[model samples]
Target: MTSTATSVIPSTSEWTPGDVEQAKEAREKLDIWPLDEYNCKLLNEVHPRNYVTNADEKEGSLVYDLIAIGAGAGGLVSSKQSARRGAKSAMITERLAGGDCLNVGCVPSKALIRSARAVSQVRRAAEFGVIVSGEVKVDFEAVMARLRRLRATIAPADGHPGTEEAGTHVYQGRGRLTGPNTVEVNGKTLKFKKCVLAMGGRPNIPSSIEGLMDAPFTTNENLFNLQVLPPRMVILGAGVVALEMAQSFALLGSQVTVVNRSSKLFESKQGDDEAAIILQNQLEKDGVTFLSSSTVQKVETINPGDGDKKLPLMKVTISDKVLECECLLVAAGRAANVENCGLEAANVDYELGKGVKVNDYAQSVSNPSVYAVGDCCAGVPRLTHMSGEMAKLVVQNSLANDQWKLSSLVVPAVAYTEPEYATVGIASEEQAKKQGVECDVYKASLEHNDRAILESSNIGFVKILVKKDTDEILGATIVAERAGEMINEVSLAMKNNLGLYAIGRNIHSYPTTGEAVMGCGVQYINKHLPRLD
Candidate 1:
């Protein structure tokens, strides 16, 4: 697992006078920290002088209390928590510190989604009795500019300075495990008592598609880099990223088409078909075309020949049909960054397509001294919050004596679509039945919700599954405008082992989306009430 190529970090010695002035101007314009040559050198240094003590004084060994690989949410949290508890911690990262969530995944996508939602709301302003106005248009450049501005502003918090300020030694290089407790970075060996791997994941590209490798395309990593919106966009895959981007781009005036090999949009195991249909229908209404049970056989980029300024077009083949678009976005899935990281050298068990093998406690099964979290951990949910939760558990297990196991049941997942879908605990009723658990289901439609009625957004429902003859809430799902925010209440209930009765007894704010959760709970409780004489 040795790295064939070493990471190269920009140095201050290479910067010219113009480079510094340009960086200063960009920083002032975006209100972001200047990534000048000095800052770049500082962030990319292999080891800072202040942190690494003389190895000769300590018997020729540079030992740290904890070592965290990857600077994403999990690694950041692990290092911070360890340092806060008086442990000498070190974190190593080869790329940007925040990983996918801040750089390419959550933050940028949400920013674009918010801009798209604004366009939708403006288009529907007539429903709110607003006066007649001119046609609404999306300033694509402005939207992207704002996204860049926001990302730059938030970047410093996850940069080297932020982690160093938290009392953790920050190392900027690719970290490879030279031994079970030794990490080698930039020709320097860092021995640690405990280590946590949070290398995260990258967008998975399908190699089977003909000409796809040579075709110009955008994944989540570079989607926000677009300065001008494509007139037509073809997206591969119908998972969360594809669907979310499809809706957003369609709303922002792109003629978007989504191609999927499966007949269904979301995976059947984790997603409800009914909920998928509801979201699909909404996206279709917004001018997004979906080709289910279809796959992209090949792609060819051709010059439109309209003018010099015309962007190149992508010709995609799906079965007997051919679709052309200005851009192609591959959102099939994600691959864990487990390669060339010395997992084999460390004797950590890992699968090729999957990730590092770990138990419920996130500890490496083959090596007790090592732990893996986030997208790099096989069988764990690859969500930002889930990574943060695993970080806490890793910190507890690494530093404290407490041995806490990671629980997937209490973790909630949300797809941030227009009418968001959220679920927690055991979502599949058949799985519960297979486990010999009898469940009672209670449902409430958003159509009956007062807030939904007022907003004319009564298109989803809240469903709760309770153990039959008991108040135990096995699972809950919410489909509404604010499902992401509403699902937290159910997650909190599950975490505290509270029953549906407790949720029902609790009062929610009037005329709010949260009432739907309370209503489902009340429905369950009332359905089981005993008959009186």
Candidate 2:
């Protein structure tokens, strides 16, 4: 295997002793471990050193059958599937192998949300016919600590050790395409017969707002690391992430204000206006403020000065009014991490703002040997579960002679708020109407559900759309406490060509939120049946 000596940065004239120690610790963390029994066992049939060696050693020879670029859910799944099929595989990553889902996005956010939910439940204990204590206080520090601990426990499953255990070589470095069949990571170049890019994405910070970069702000990347809750927080972009955190933080004792350019909160395409209004009303009741059709014109930091130790405050100008807060969060959107990956050098067609161009099989349109998935790919839904589905398709297409495509997959998406919102298949009723297809929409409010009423969490509804004459299930939207979990049944029905009649005929256990789906189906069937004279 090839090895290179680590270079030490020349000491600056104004360097401090603490800086030196920090650098030393960082270097120690980056040290490569020698292959031992554990490493050997993890690597299994493949030698680990082969992946770290110079490209010359494997030149003209395929080092692996499949090489996944990013070690997120998509890349990890691709590698594991390839290895299970007896194809040599390796995964290269720039950051933690688990990518954002394990590190920053899903795992951490959900942990915080769970903690926030506990607080909300305790505060509303009286509503459930239970007596409460003197006051419900949120220990913000302890809450954050619990989130960190949980993340650490779940991290190893997506770390280097986990990837190695899955029989894939793990390379920790920025992987760039040097050739059509070759990737360069760290100082080593590896050749592969097939490659999949799953490099994921990052939070998109808008550049239109002046002084936004200079001001103290947080994104999903560092938001979970906050130890103490800010007294007041201003969030830009009333998207899924912003709304979720706004409610969470406000419930956790922060005065939260959401400012958005659009008059409506959620997007019109995937989200229902009625659902958005309900969610907005719920959030407002919980002490969160919304500034709709507003833009942050400028941000100015106010310092106490005079050697004051207080945290600086921010004065934000939104439209004609000014809002001051201690913290600002930018949840505008996500941008694909397609740059600096040598896509141009490899002739992979991609666009700025948009991601890599791919075909039905997840294969790059420009280079058939290479494929892209997850947020890095263009035109695919930017959801973790969707990425996993794309990964499976890429693996099947790569390993087997017969290729499977992603076109037929029924994907479900969820936004994890207090009353979660989930949708599957075609969610828009208006779009169905615009297409000239006669469809029926059936809805059931959670207020009528036994489980929701018992739990005092009756806040949302379930709406299902189906073909008018045939009773075929077309799309569904569930807005409730466990909408994320409840939407799966609808997705399954659509996948298997099940109709509303089947759902209505099936028995749903009494006193559960899931019964709402069955209730919607029953309503549809009752409405469509021949009228009694």
Candidate 3:
């Protein structure tokens, strides 16, 4: 490993008592750690002189040029790119080897979702012209075990920290800033020329809800860990987290009740008004209850009847009514991991909830040398895939002869509910006013789509926004089965500056949800009379 120090600063060059004192003095002056009061303790015992000394007897440590705190999607991409771009870097995080995705987030959640979906399909196999089974049963524990094993198998490729390069290092510890350009990891001080805070965020459960803290509740991180499915579950949010898990659990055989402080579950998507009614109506038919516009006042846990292994039941009081559930899954929201990073002292400019502010380049507003991304540093959407792109922007802007910027790309956010919600680009009305860009919106109901008719996913639609004067596409939203896949075409249109005319001319496959894209384009073409015509 090649260790290089900054040329802007002078090194003592020798390991005499005076040099040791000088090193300690410099660390204290920079507030970089190994302070004078603890210098002897760290040098003689904690770190040890031989531990840091070189083969030629030069007492030195690897001073990385860049340090990335967190090994999640954002951190790994940033570190790898930084190393490849010829910068000395290191990544630090506090988890069981992998970050949330491989250990708990995407890997476990999606695996369980797919497993639940399998059970759901099998239960309805008789509808598909197959009649067999003495009552459909679920061996949820075995399913969970399989999910855990699969997560372990896939950890190395997606979760393993650090790259194979010589200059980059990965360590397992919670990194905290002790100086503007310095970080201390479990007492080991790592100094770097630049820093990137990719540590992401944690679930934000409100404190005003009284006994929620003392109660045995589950977050997205712990919800999928349950080997035995709960008999009843009360989810407390209307956001993506709450909605996704609510659908997953309900399908997995749990009696689910979604209590949102709003009347509708998904109000963000345009035309979701009708779809929300349809979803609630369908889920209610399948034993899912909706306690809309309700607030979870408090919760108290009672012993479970199953056994010691089974989790205790939670009794939640919403408004003036009392409701009981075998488990309470809290997916309220998420907060940035920015508390102890010394942003105020570092003069890092940030918004109330957006995190370390960045323009198109993903550079920190407070310090151009520093950058942030991921859940903590939200870009267009706070998705793992989007954060990976943001980290790429940081890497490109920081080094090499690259001129690409990430803001130019289109990002899509997917809420993995039963009928997944996926959207991209500007809202029709908002775009019209925001840029004074005249636009016409064309919406095609899935009720008319042959694919939707076959799949029973006719409750959604594909909405398109086009520039009224020029027919240039502005945005699109799809709320249907495989909406995540369908939203990409709209994103591609916005990315390539494609117009409604081009989309209308493009032939879409029949008996598919994406045909709605061409349908919308045709509708837009029909709405306006061409000047040539």
TM per candidate: 0.89, 0.88, 0.82
lDDT by residue (1-533, candidate 2, tens digit) is 11221122212122122344433432243221112232222222222222342212334333778999998889989987787677777788766556778767898799998998898888888887889879899998788767766766776667555556556666657899998888998877788889999999988988888888887777887677565678899999888889889999999999999997888866645467788898999899888999998899998878532111244588999999998887789999888989999888788999776799998899999998899999999898888988889999999888784578878889988889989989887676775776777887889999878999887789899999888777788888889999999999898889999888888888998878999999988987787789879
Each model's total of backbone clashes: 0, 0, 2
lDDT by residue for model 3 (297-368), tens: 988777544322566877899998888888888877777777777676556677545577776677777676
The lDDT, on a scale of 0 to 1, for candidate 3 is: 0.68
The weakest ten consecutive residues by lDDT in model 1 span 1-10
- Local lDDT at 410 for model 3: 82
Off by over 4 Å in 2: 1-62, 268-270, 303-312, 434-437, 530-533
lDDT of each: 0.80, 0.78, 0.68
| Model 3 TM-score, 2 decimals | 0.82
**Residue-by-residue lDDT tens digits, candidate 1, 241-281:** 99899999999999999998888766545566678789999
Model 2, CA-based lDDT: 0.78
Q: Comparing candidate 1 with candidate 3, which one achieves the higher TM-score?
A: 1
**Superposed model 3: Cα runs more than 4 Å off:** 1-61, 96-98, 165-167, 268-271, 304-308, 351-354, 378-380, 401-407, 427-438, 528-533
For model 3, what is the alpha-carbon lDDT of residue 512? Answer: 87
